[model samples]
Target: MCLLAFQLQKHPKYKLIMMANRDEAYNRPTTPADFWSDYPDILAGRDLEQMGTWLGINKQGKIAALTNHRDFSLPETGGQSRGHIVSSYLQSNETPEDFLEQLHNSKNEYSGFNVLVGSSEELYYYSNIEQKTEHLKNGTHGLSNAFMNTPWPKTEAVKKLLCDYAESTNEIDVDVLFNMMQRAERFPSEQLPDTGVGGELESMLSSIFIASKEYGTRCTTVLLVDSEDQVYFEERTFKNGVFATAQKFSFTIENPTA
Candidate 1:
């Protein structure tokens, strides 16, 4: 997940609302989002190359998502698959705090990455690059390659859009969220971050929906949990930023025993 925007605990009729786009190489092999056969409770797309996932949820009402943090100094083969960090949380019964506290010791083994885990009711953010973890407040937030809500042009733009979505209605308009992902507006060169990558490359990656011949936006996903505790997950996959397919899954979050 290169770009992520979400509104939590701020909507009248929803517990959480989120929209994200995963950017990857056009040639990389990936499976569309689905309930894993081995871990049938887990729902997410598989990174075939690593047998992990960038984002996922389980029947236990657990949610987890991961985004790579750009760091040129790190070797391509960092200790572990960052995707596995997300997949691991989905399969475990640990609370986000406990899970991350354990990972703190070994986080250095992984490549630069930021991770979010816990149910919508109690989300937590941690980045190995920043070496910090904190409970996300109830409000709109964004994440990209740098850090949580670093005000990157794309992050700031979509955060406002997501904020509107959260405040707009009793339920989110999936279409509105989907269309926002199609934004291709490139940030001006001067406004882009210089994270070691050259200005030319940064500009190309500035858009919410990227379109490069070798690499681009791979999928757009919208996830929501309503006031009644219904969960909806949708994904639209693409090839070079062109829509290729879409998938949807729905469930209800079981209430805790009194």
Candidate 2:
């Protein structure tokens, strides 16, 4: 996932509300969100290339999402697939803290990344670049290629959009959340962050929804977990900058606290 904005335990009707966009190359093989035949409990879009996922939530209430840490200064040495970071956590029974602690040792085996893993009741954020695992507080937060809530123009704007929509209504609207993430408005040049990808590319990626000939947002996902343990997931995919198909799933957590 390239961008994420969420409200955790800050809304009256829902325990967790999240919207994310996954930007990738047009040719990367992928499967839309669904329960794996091999692991039926896991619901997520699969990266066919690595046999991993970027975001997922299993029937046991385990949720995980990952984003790459963009730093062109470092050489692109091949390493373990970062997508496995999300899939591994969702497939394991380890608590967020435990999984992160274990991952800390082998972080370098993979490229720099930021991962969020936890259940609807609790969530944590960790980044290999910063080498810190944070027990996320109950509030609205945003994550992108940088550190959590780093106030990059896109991050801040999306965070505010989520915070406003969440605070103003007791009932959550999935379409509204999806619409918020579809914003393709790039920020002003002066307000963009310098990620070493030049001004042109930086401006293009500044928007929540990215569209380019080669690399752009391929899909958008919305996840909502209510106080009653009802889980709702929806993924809308795009084909070469245009909408393609959408998949939706709903299920109640069997043992949310366990």
Per-model TM-score, in order, reads 0.96, 0.98
Instruction: Report clash pairs, candidate 2.
Output: none
Candidate 1 ranges with C-alpha deviation above 4 Å: 73-77, 255-258
Put down candidate 1 lDDT per residue, 117-209, tens digits, no spaces: 888787999988778898999899999898998989999999998887667677678999999988998989888888878878989999988
Worst 10 residues of 1 by lDDT: 249-258
Query: Can you give the lDDT of residue 191 in candidate 1?
Result: 83
Q: Residue 30 in model 1: shift from native, Å?
A: 0.5
What is the overall TM-score of model 1 with all chains considered together?
0.96
RMSD of each: 1.8, 1.0
Candidate 1 local Cα displacement, residue 61, angstroms: 1.4
Query: Highest TM-score among the candidates is held by which one?
Result: 2
User: Candidate 2 on 177-206: residue-level lDDT in tens?
Assistant: 999999998999999878899999999999
Give, for candidate 2, the lowest lDDT window spanning 10 residues. 70-79
